[model samples]
Target: MPHPILETTDLTVRFGGHVAVDHITCNFNAGELTAIVGPNGAGKTTYFNLISGQIPVSEGRVKLNGTDITRMSVAQRTHRGIGRAFQLTNLFPNLSVLENIRLVVQSKAGRGFNILSMADSHAELTGPAYEILERIRMTDQADQVVSELSHGDQRKLEVALLIALDPLVYMFDEPTAGMSVDEAPVVLDLIAELKTRKDRAILLVEHKMDVIRTLADRIIVLHNGALAADGDPAEVMASDVVQEAYMGRDLEEALANV
Candidate 1:
């Protein structure tokens, strides 16, 4: 097996007297899409936060390609090729789509000092910014202010922002949380496309089993801050432990309909 692009060893997180994430260890291999699923308060997002350096770990360590990054700050992790999209859409609402992406491109290029300059003057940044727009199918909306776009479009732009960072591992926390059923597929397709790249690793925290079933190469189920099940999607979903603890009878009915 290929060495994991990202890994955690006995990772733990505590909130005063409460434990948000128990001692858990797992590896995310390059080119794989691993779905982290569980009921509410399952520690799925907490795990993402720990690995992405959004929060400090109380125990264990996070490693990227064998390099220990447990002590790295959020920006430091981003600089080291870790990118994440939160459950809520993160975008510059007042900026045009292209402009929003351009800023990220500029920041990544270490040209934050020139952010006040005309965006058109920087072909190096604008060029790639346009390219990302094309990839996200947002080129036509490039000049539209983010606030003017639909909720789904804003979600797409958020993913585009992450793409602009060019991270080795992409962590998506409920990327389709508030999207309409029709809009959900648009973001899902983008994620599916990202999974096709052989050098990138994708870690997702999602509650939609249909989405998880369609895209996950592997599924990790968390319950009460501990791992409940981890394996192929079908097997994990079929497991009595998961069905009893998380999915219950509804999952079986859902799967039966399929």
Candidate 2:
């Protein structure tokens, strides 16, 4: 088996006297998709922050490919191959879809800040940028302003930007947070395709059980700032602790339909 691309040892996060995340340990292996699900305030996103360097760990360590990165800055982690798509849309609304992605490609190449001067002249960036657009099925909307695209397309664009970074581990915080039913599948399919790569590790914090059921190879359940269950999706879903803490009776109902 391949080594874990990301791992945490007794990871914890504290806010004042409150513990948002307790001493939790988990490993995310390459070529796998792991879903982290829990009730609200279960420290799901907090755990992602601790690993992504959005927030510091109160105790414990985050390791990427066996290297301790507990103190790495967000930018440093990004360069070290940790990429994230936030629960909220984070994109330049004013820029065109192509421009938004090109900037990331350029940044990844270590170019200086020259958005205006480089926008028209950077053919090197355009090739890879357009390739990403094509992969995301947004090539037709390349020149369209990001604000003008539908919310679902914008979300897909966000993932595309992450693909441009080509990180070893991808952390998605509710990639389908606020989308209509039709829009939800578009983003879901994009995520599904990522799972086929078999060369990257994907960790997602999702509330939607159907999405989790369909995409997750493994599931990690969190409750009240601690690890509740971690195992195969079927086994984890059947767990009484998970059913009582979060799924309640709906899990059985949902599984029956599946």
Instruction: Estimate the TM-score of every prediction.
Output: 0.91, 0.91
Per-residue alpha-carbon lDDT of model 2 for 1-258, expressed as tens digits? 678999999999999999999999999998899998777789988998999999988999999999999999998898888999888889999999999998889879887566567467879989999998887778999999999998888888887788888888989988876677876786788778888998899998877777888999999989899999999999988889888765576554643432
User: lDDT of candidate 2?
Assistant: 0.86
Model 2 clash tally?
A: 0
Residue pairs in collision within model 1: none
lDDT of 1 by residue, 51-122 (tens): 999889999999998999999999889888899987888789999999999988988998887647776898
After best superposition, candidate 2 residue 25: deviation in angstroms?
Answer: 0.4
lDDT of each: 0.87, 0.86
Off by over 4 Å in 2: 113-117, 247-258
